[model samples]
Target: MAAYPENNRTWQIIHNARKGGYAVGGFCVYNAEGVLAVIKAAERCRSPAMIQFFPWTLHFHGPAFIKYAAEVARAASVPISIHLDHCLKPSDADLALECAFDSIMVDGSMYDEEGNIKYVKSVVDRAKDKGITVEAELGRMEGGEDGLPTIDLESVFTDPDMAADFVKKTGVHFLAPSFGNVHGPYPAGGAEKHWRLDRLEKIHAALGDATPLVLHGTHPLSDEMIRVGMARGMVKVNQNRNVRNGYHEYIAENCTKVELTTLQVEAVEAYSKGVERLMVEVFDSAGKA
Candidate 1:
């Protein structure tokens, strides 16, 4: 098995990724294709990155899938972090950590305040022993993910004060607090375009400079919004939907007379450029590796 990052803390890697002036890409993977696409992009850019999966998808791919992906990433010359995203159950959290994931995110923000704190603390204790970084959600996400239902502004907002307390109590290394972000693509002409940047800034201030904040469901937002998010302490930005859509679109546009393998390579190449563009232009992370 490959060794974990020398830091052994996801926050340290992301804090460096942020101070280095480039947002760390947390690409969500469902299968080998997703993992391959992300790693290739990171390597081509000569940057450090993260690959993660929603726990619901883990049921289909199995926990062994993370181990396989970790080994593949370990063989790469660039630094890579493997993470389990939005794990709701303790068993799932324990399994991912045992499988040697560098980070585990226990997303219990949908629960009430007491429930959220309790879950975060329990997972933190479990993950700490294994030298795995833990991330706890402070706010509820707007759109559905992992079969969870969508939440609106009234339902999904995170209390800045509560978020600070949650982080302190749980001793989580990273925080994924929702600020008008969703799980799926954003709606055209919706409030998502104008994300709650001020709210996010406030949350960052409450959490202080030490804890890195992750931005979830950032695909459909505009470049300006994404850049603002990075400046406001969003060290890690999740960008799975954009990658999937870009890859699929390229294959469909160019596969008229090509074989499946050719189309697959073409999609990979296209997605690589697409990811590179986002990292270099929007995230300003071209040479921060």
Candidate 2:
């Protein structure tokens, strides 16, 4: 068997969450403050965390920024890992593999099942040598996040049995299944009306505890619904706009009133507060460091 999903920082934190009956938040970040916010929240709550960056950051902030984020996160008292989210292009995956990230979400959802498996398997093969675990999205998620592409096609739910086969074939450490979960905010009905917990349950059952489930499309998901996903085996919950809104609100309100340094400090605090709440209340990861 491959030595992947075993020794890496991301794998270790997530594995601990799995064993401890809790979930770690995959907090997506774009800048230095975003990095600090996650570290602050994880340390304050004593929770394990994954600081995620989209592929845009790779080109915008560059690899040095990713290394800085990883350095900062790894230095925290709590268990924190740096992860590259939604590496859509194989080239981006290639670039991410050379960075300081502890994990990379290899998104092959745009491809056919066989193509996705082959693509993910290729990255997984290379990632093992770099000591970085990999996360693979099995089905296409509708809508999009800040840096991800918006797919006009309907959301494709992941097949439970196929998820297992994909995991086995690709040697992926984490699985983000699309089961009625869109990328952005839900339509008229909220996540409560759209999320298919039954499908998630089946996927979890198919993969068991060996492979962790990642909850995506969680912008407006209720705390109760989040808790329900955890019950069904979502060990890593991806939080993008969900936790960063507080930071945005603070920045918008205080940009003209406060000094740049002061604004950044307080803004990070606001972001951390949002992350800390989830760690303490919903994820049950606080004090699990």
Candidate 3:
């Protein structure tokens, strides 16, 4: 059984943050260090945080790892939820459910509008039976994460009217719309175009505040952009590359001098600091728990 009932702790955390005009960080974890980092950061900062896994990460690490994540969430002082991020198929969602995820993102955005709605609704129906919260994507996100191919921006930008319809039709707990955000890191110089807050505002207007919005591709966005998105009803922001960057940078910087065991410890510490910085400084979820 899940430690916290599905849609109970996770939903309350997100809904409360949305109502309070703050955003929770959905930090993607691929290993024990990643999971420990997120949980420790949340506990230290007193923030409501989420530890998420991509389908590929789950494939690499296996379902048993999820139990460890669940155990950590159950033992944590602050609110934390384990979520499956960007599941492309219903079977993927089912696998996550089996692993006892509190929330799942059923991403059928590669399909046509009708097909996307149909697929997401099917997953939503199943998740609802388990009392699990479902988050579905309506707009395709550009840039690839976990070996997915990159998509063009023009083809994937979400339509406000369609977003409203999709939310009502699928009954998802949250919606991730493509409003000028992409997965993966921005170029070294930064993205030429800024996050289209105006477009996000339009979607907020169409969907109203009842439907909480989720923003993916959060790695390279500025603090101001994040604050603007949260103010416009974005309740969850997924950040992975930045955390990975921090981990890799730490290893690269310290690997030569440190013992192998100490190196691993340093990596976790660095990654935790990176994630904590986002939780406290960037996302503003610190102390919100």
Candidate 4:
């Protein structure tokens, strides 16, 4: 292993994607089934994967659960890293840095530009000591996810002009720029109409390949749009429910018919199948392990 991010699992996975001209999915999971699904899919496809969790997992499941997730992820046959997604609170960041996460997304969007920079920088400095790479949101992503709350504030898009400076000042490893991407479902026109690919391109051009770009708000995104992001600079694609639809369907249909134990087994298998499809289809990470 090398120093800092070079030694980190998520960094190397994302960097490998950038070099290979593809994007790696950071699968956001909530439970044991989700964790198992990511590992199984990555191993089956021989893809480098990252399992992501919201702040809820860290708190609800506790630190022990995070350790368990990280342990299994690290032991995977292929490169599988564990990440904490949308760590909004400073306390959450503190708790996450102490865990076994390979990387963490420091969500400082609640603060102003200066406050966000300082908060992220402080986390980055502390994270270095623990050998964890940091990913932070440059501007506020609208809507809410499983663990996040709804914001009444207006959406703030990341300025391409300030993109490079934000990365330079914060010392963050990955940049998740908010360019008309929402956390949950899209508005009337869907992602095709709402996504600002041109703005995304500008952000990527400003940062270049030095700081890998992360794609968020992919609930109902089309595969074509995903390709557009990867072609631009999205190296790490954070996925939540889109990849688990099959598993959710299976559970909903078979929960009453199948035994509890069998339900979980088949559910995870279904989940892995969906993830494997994305591995080969959208992300194109299959066989890159």
Candidate 5:
């Protein structure tokens, strides 16, 4: 295993990437096998990357796994940071921070604007005390548990002025503003339905260049859209569902010929290669880390 990123190492990388007009990869990992693959890929590429675990992963695998994976990654000399992704509540985020995660993203954009600000400020205050980075959401992500009962797409777009105000009040290190970006895969050559570049530019204009902007649900976009996002103040790109599916497909294709240990080993290898490929090809994050 490679060494873990130093404390504050991940945020610094993210900050620098923003300055350089590139997005750093924030690959999601749900288990030890996934962690190994993400770290190995980033190490081989000589890139700084983030490994994130959803709160539900802890329910299935328990918190010990998260700690163990983080410890192993830290030991490796690679600039790898562990983050708790899409924490559903403040308590879950508090637990992750206490567990020594370098960062936690609070997804409270589902609330009313005022409620969202209050929730973010509370989390930011708690995380900053530990020197942990906090990422707050501005616009609600539709069709997810992160949102309220409303499923209307009309409620989805972010208000640039409101987003900037939320940041100013909360003092979060990064912001994930919904600019028409959605969670699932898109149709073939789809009209890039989600992620309005103009909206992103407006938000950037409002928030200014110092803030690191993260584009969630980044997988469904075309290469052109991704490049446009990078050019417009997006510093971190999250790729969870795409990479997981890629790894599973690789495993299914090659599993029939392998023994148990070999199958597990091959799956890890394939997953690691897939991640490296995403870093180099899809995300254009190679050498930016």
Candidate 6:
């Protein structure tokens, strides 16, 4: 059995963080090195953190990787949750549950309101039986991450009324509503377009404090914006672009002289450093475990 079961502590981690005025960072990783980097950073900072795997990551690494991540989470000094991020299908959610993932994000935002709710409810019903937490997105986010398509920003910002109704009907533990955030990098000189706290606050007001909010595509937001968002109930922030960039930068800078074995070590160190900064500096989650 896992040290921290998804159904119980995973939900608590977000709720506690929100109540205590801190935001936990959800770091996405594709390989063992990336996993180690996130766990090591969380351990060093004593932060409650989450290691997330996207749909493509599961396809690339297989179900065995989830067990590997569970082992890492078990061994870590601080609390860690193994989460399946951006799962689009019920089968994918079932696979993650079968692999013992602590939490799963069911992304049915591509569909209309009724369709999204039905899809998310199906996953939630299954997950609840096994004690897993479900996160569902309400509005479509523009720009793609991990091969997903870019949606139009104008039509996709989440509505507060719709958000409240969605949560009530779906029984999702966390909500990822599109305020203005997108996946991957922001357009050049367009950082302002990526975050809208007024919209976020409205959602918070509608949903109230009990349901913790999640921020996806947070890599491009400034630290102040992140702080502002968290202050209004954003409990989990997903960061991938910076971590991947840091890992690649380190490997590119030193791969010529380093042995292949050393490359992995260097990548872990680089990724860990970036994750550490995000936890300790940006999210203010360090030492909150």
Off by over 4 Å in 6: 1-7
lDDT of 6 by residue, 198-257 (tens): 898999999987678998877577887778778877899988877677888988899898
TM per prediction: 0.90, 0.97, 0.91, 0.98, 0.89, 0.93
**Best-first order by TM-score:** 4, 2, 6, 3, 1, 5
Report the C-alpha lDDT of model 4 over 1-289, residue by residue, as the tens digit: 4887798888899999999988899999989999999999999999999999988987798999999998998889999999999988999999998899989999889899999999999999999999999999998888879878788777788999888999999999999999988989888998888888889999999998889999999998999989988888999998999989999999999999989999999999999998999899999999999
Cα lDDT, model 3, residue 286:
90
RMSD of each: 2.9, 1.6, 2.7, 1.0, 3.7, 2.4
Q: Which residues of candidate 2, in runs, are more than 4 Å off?
A: 1-3
lDDT of each: 0.78, 0.91, 0.82, 0.92, 0.76, 0.84
lDDT of 6 at 242: 77
Model 3: what TM-score?
A: 0.91
The weakest ten consecutive residues by lDDT in model 6 span 1-10
Question: What tens digits encode model 3's per-residue C-alpha lDDT throughout 41-151?
Answer: 888899999999898866887888888888888899988988999999667777877776888998897789999999888887877777688888888777778756677
For candidate 2, the per-residue lDDT at 113 reads 94
For this target, which candidate reaches the highest TM-score against the unseen true structure? 4
lDDT measured at residue 251 in model 6 versus the true structure, 0 to 100: 89
Between candidates 5 and 6, the lDDT winner: 6
Clash list (residue pairs), candidate 2: none
Write one digit per residue (lDDT tens) for candidate 1, span 1-289: 3343336745556877867867888888777777788788888887778888888666787877878898998887778888888888777776776775889888886678888888888888877778788877887776776555666656467778988888888888889887777777667754445477789889989987678888887757678777878888888888777767788788778888788788877787777777777777787766666
Runs in model 4 with CA error above 4 Å?
none
